[model samples]
Target chain A: MFSGSVWKNIAVLGIVALISGITVFTVHAITKGYIIKSESRYAKRFLFQVAPNANYTNDILTDTINIPKKYFSMLGIESGEIHLVKINGKLISIIVPSIAYDGYNGKIKILVGINLDGSIVSVRVVSHKETQELGDKMEVVKSDWILNFNKKSLNNLEPKSWKVKKYGGYFDQFTGATITPSAIIKQVHETLKYYEMDKSRIIKELDVFNEIKVSNNFEGGN
Target chain B: MYIRSYKSILNNGIWEENQGLILFLGLCPLIAVSNSVVKALGLSIATMFVLLFSNITISLIKKRVSGILKIPIFIIIIATFTTIIELFMKVFMYELYILLGIFIPLIIVNGLILNRAEIFACKNSVVKSAFDGLIFGMGFSAVLITLSAVREILSVGKIFINMDLLFGSAAVDWSITIFSEGYSFLLFMLPPGAFILLGFLIALKNLIDGKVNTLSGNERSSLKKETKRVRTTGPVA
Candidate 1:
């Protein structure tokens, strides 16, 4: 079998593939549950950060609505979850995570929390690959530039003002990195507009999401 | 195959054949993640896991691996171990996994692991290969940690800022800020800073090596170049 024959080569390859496949499968099986837990935990952390003051009685982590492609696609993301923030058994606000694809380096993930009246409660940059000092100014830790999105909504700002100040918009883009802030502003504005257009449906979608989760859990339990 | 003493193996890995410093292997990741001590240590541990497991498996199956199928087989084995490490880190050390990002998966192509498999692990016993992997990993990590420390101190005037991400909640206060806010040498945190620091580290390693050789009265020619180079055991083409 150690002979350098074509058949031996194939046999060795087959054995290697089988072993590697089994090893990978074992690891994936062992870590799948914990990985899912960490991901949901991370999402919940962002939820709390975006709407820190929202007195949500329910577990906002579990209460999620999947954004439809028509709305999410414009923001350069394939899909996203709208985490509903409920207070005193009543819906108060929603936290929406969106991606700005035109960012200078790449995609910039932003989470926007909007109040029941459609005004923004807060905005947080969950993740981005922007330039460290310049584009990273979008991060709350780096600068107060991100706070500009707070308390502002589509109704307050004219549609034309969605662009950065360099483009005659209200928001101030970082001095060296205009593309990142401009892209974020444009996409955040669009996300707000999309929410406004389907406000009723988006809110009602939460009930549907809850029902689906309940049924899925019931099916899995059986 | 000639069996070298364990002490010689350790010396070879740590000082003589250090993948990061001596051979200048894996410079890309060495600089990329070495900006922060915790991040470098996290990646180093991940690489160690991959190397250890890949070396053992490759050694165990070395006899069965035909000459023609060696490269593809080694690659599959290395990739499988890398995936295993990545998955484990994502589960237990989720924060570090996210911080290290693509570099975790990119460990398969680090060239260090594959080169070890082709050169040392494939020809050695399982125990020897495992030891080699561990020592080589430590050697590389030493360089990574040193470079990261230099960069972290110079760039931000802080040391161990986020130990909790790698350690735990109890280690949250491990961060040491040498300077207060509003002051930082920002250039050292950037890519160019990484290059400068790495250049100094490589030079330091060479200088030490040269001093040690001269003190021992050993001519450079006494060191076998063949021993330093990894001969190809893969497909000739």
Candidate 2:
């Protein structure tokens, strides 16, 4: 209660804090629109690549893939679920944005679209914090060998079958990127596992993704 | 406050008082975004604009600002101007804005701005501060553009022409080609390449300076010794 003048110090600090806060808020407001557009552009390639067989119009991220209300109960976001792409009244590829956390560095985000029979349409790396030369070679410009993954089936695929040739397995690792290719193979196997485990429910849930936006809007409004 | 001629002004930017290669200000963005010519150019232009405007404003208000609160007042003024340029980039060059990222916000830390505020802005008239800023901006841009050109040519195998995204239709075809076929030196675009190219560029600058010095009867001074002899600063390209 009898200190030397805390009020003066508090007032100065308060003014500085207020000014700094306002400046940050203003900078964010000024940059928000551009940042959103740029991020969307970066992510759009993933959706389109993974679902090449499907026709998408407008900003794809804004549109959602609808899971059937009947099958929605069986699927959890944290647990991973199944959904299908729907064009004007017909069904298309199944959309699967999967997180392969056991990647070379951090989680390698992959959006994989597969036909009901398990043929991959395409794959896109949404985010990956891989190693300098090894894991980063996953990019097409660097080590495009991942292109070999196309058109392969998993019916008789063995676990050991899903590994780098360095370990005497199927896939090839980058020049020095064994872990990256290995992680990719492991994640692909998991994606296939998830698809196979819930095939019947997923099959029943097909042709419902077109209504995703409507459901989302209804939920948001409430 | 008194720049006698063009040579003196050029000397101010290029040597006696440099924003980067000499002054050592703005090293953060200089290192972060020098991976390509387009990005470096985008950031250089933005910084130039901010430096020019803030110098003018600070010089105008130098007399009015109290000694007790000059730094805070100076920061407020610079931040106001920096935000304006950031908004312009966001609206007009969205792709460039995205590539520059957080480094744009970090421009507030750039010592070039503060150096001018403390040195020229606090003492000079508005017109002189503006000239100093303009020369400093040119020097910074020259270094940035040259460094980015070298990087993009070696790493990306191409230079410029993301114009549809950065400058809209007008800049389409504005990009020039340095190569004809597949000849990318990928390592040049990496962060390590930044250090390598920067080392080589500084060496080049020293070589040129040595030649100039030799012509002026100072051939005894070695270029290696010259660069090392002096403390350098931001926009280090």
Candidate 3:
């Protein structure tokens, strides 16, 4: 025969289990909608920042890109390296975010947004755990030092011009944070080098910019 | 199964078995994203969702589950709930998810969940155990959020509630600015800040516990004497 108390214990536990399960499920289901919205907004912001200054106002997350599974071998599609910018219907530019290896602390995460014609739109610091005032001052948010790297093409930046003011480059190092600024300039040089070498491949892959097609023309076209 | 008393519910969650501050569970996510208040809040809330459901599901099935296979069953239940939360996190709070990264899935390993399944859910009735799970989860999350808030405020010299973020648009700009632009204290937001704050908080809790016990000690002497007499009498000839 079963133990004297086993049945009683079972009844209590059974009720407890059912109630707990139902309540928790209820809360989770209720909050699911809010959580989804938050995630989409976050991804949208990053997508815009990481891509380019286009009105990429698609229902972004739901908007699927029909990328080939074998996209790995595609040309100008540098995998994790493509930036997309569009203006007036035609694709204006596509810059791949790359790194400059000579950062003072280490390699800085740089997202260099460029146009098809080799003109730079912007370079943002994706991340840098460098020192404050000096090293971390290299951030575009912290100072205009990063802005100086804009527009200057491969031919314009001479190797000797790569140094900071302290090191003789046009860029000024922070009054006390020379290592930080110098590192950024060095990164800028390397970023340009990467872009020069891989521009076509990167642009070809980020088809996010290709929205114009002559589909569904009216039968009464003038 | 019923809330026969209020004190038991509070005590169960607060400390006798705290999720993180005492049990040392979920330390990985607790330490990593705790660099700022906002980051910590996002993670804390996300974790609460996972813990709440997993506890309930595990408790419901405790009777049917084999004692030997209880551990794996607990894991599957916890994993399914965690995955649901993960998908929700990715779709809605993508920024928090990206920042949280591996730590989100690591919730599967949070001793807090396992401990709840092994200790509370499997034994207690559904209603009682669900409250226990919530209370414990909240207590642990409360500690995490508070610690991260302290660290963030000191390090950055600001509190960005971004209420619209976790709450909704209504809470946007709800953040109270404690210190002006230049007042930010950098050290508090770093890794060292976490250890320093954790150590101080532990010391503070211990001190309070000691003080409260001392104040109540006189009334407990008679009870202690009875227990002491039983202990001392047992082994004596």
Candidate 4:
């Protein structure tokens, strides 16, 4: 159903595409396993960064609870994951990998690890599209601005005091970039509040899920 | 098609026709990632792989490609090579991959690759195109490394803080602190600093070219003697 010249063009392009596609597919297949291993290892390291001193007996990588869609919108994500950290079969903290949609340029993905008592263990910006010099100060690599969130949570400060100083709150904003820090502070506080409200339900679900999975693996082995 | 000497091609790309400095083809990553040598080197290697592979592939298929469909074919081929390089780096050099970020994928749009593909590769033999691409890619990497060194020293007061990102853990101590840790001029790390430094680099290239030309018996009048004459009588500031 094509003209002669068009057919020739299509055939040539098709051959090129097929060759390139096969090359990419082969390379991808070769690296697939390694990529998965390294990525999971990297993810584990990131978890350790968020939940410092995590002495988990269970595999934290597999011990994750996918946050329900109802709560994802509140944290600016369609879906989310809350990694469960357990030490000697007792839960210590839950790390929430969240997204802040109010960033100056675009969405800022963050990981917030909260202690059992609702205090923050650590906060890390996983990825952000903030301006290079100004807004980038929020990055822990650039400045210690993010460290200010450590050990502070909803209980320590009033709801109104959770904003950058420019907005009459405690956190310090960057010299020229106020929006980035302010947005992060606001979103982090929201994430903390979400944790507070659903703390019991989420923790209970993780515990039951872990018990069932452990029992299933035990039965399967037998 | 011009069929210049291979030695001239090498010299042209390295000095006279530098893709970065002389031609100013790819400046986005040059300015953005040149804050440190490791980041620059990461991108440099990735770009070199893409350029070399794209050139050779394009040259191989040039005769078969139709006139009207050439651009699309060239772009698709370049993008394929860039994706391969990106995926390879993501697997082996994960940290550097993260550091390079969007610039890795953005290599597809880098004018240097497409420019070389269209202008030189399409008209040349596979071997010649491969050599041209290699020389051109090296020229880009050289400029990137120099810019990175200057910026890293000026801004972070260190030469190669994260050489471990490119090299393994053994090279972690390769970083040399030039001016103590806290002593840095932030201007050199910003985007404007890139523009200023790039301007100086271009000027330096021009100055060297001028000297070389004069030494080779191509005499020109001094800048002072070539000033534009003014007809109006006024105080010359």
Give the native contact fraction of candidate 2.
Answer: 0.11
- For model 2, how does the per-residue alpha-carbon lDDT over A78-102 read when each residue is reduced to its tens digit? 4433444556645555767666666
On DockQ, the stronger of 2 and 3 is 3
As for TM-score, the candidate ahead, 2 or 3, is 3
- Model 3: per-residue lDDT, tens digit, B144-191? 887887876777666754445556666767667677765545566566
Sorted by DockQ, highest first, which candidate order results? Answer: 1, 4, 3, 2
**How much of the true A–B contact set does each candidate keep?**
0.73, 0.11, 0.19, 0.41
Model 4 chain B poorest ten-residue lDDT run: B224-233
The model with the greatest TM-score is: 4
* Residue-level lDDT tens digits of model 1 in B44-156: 99899989989998899888775768899889988998898888888777888898999998998999999899988988999999999999989999999989998888887
Candidate 1 on A15-96: residue-level lDDT in tens? 7799789978987988899999988887777788777484678788887777777775765677777888887646788888
Clashing pairs in 2: A66-A209, B20-B233, B20-B234, B23-B233, B24-B233, B24-B234, B25-B234
TM-score for each predicted model, relative to the true structure: 0.83, 0.72, 0.72, 0.84
**lDDT score of residue A43 within candidate 3:** 42
- What C-alpha lDDT, on a 0 to 100 scale, does residue A139 get in candidate 1? 81
Better of 1 and 3 by TM-score: 1
Better of 2 and 3 by lDDT: 2
DockQ of each: 0.53, 0.13, 0.19, 0.36
> Given candidate 3, what's the lDDT at residue B102?
86
Q: Model 2: runs farther than 4 Å from truth?
A: A1-39, A57-59, A65-84, A100-107, A129-137, A141-144, A156-158, A198-222, B1-7, B81-96, B153-193, B217-237
How well does candidate 4 match the true structure in TM-score terms? 0.84
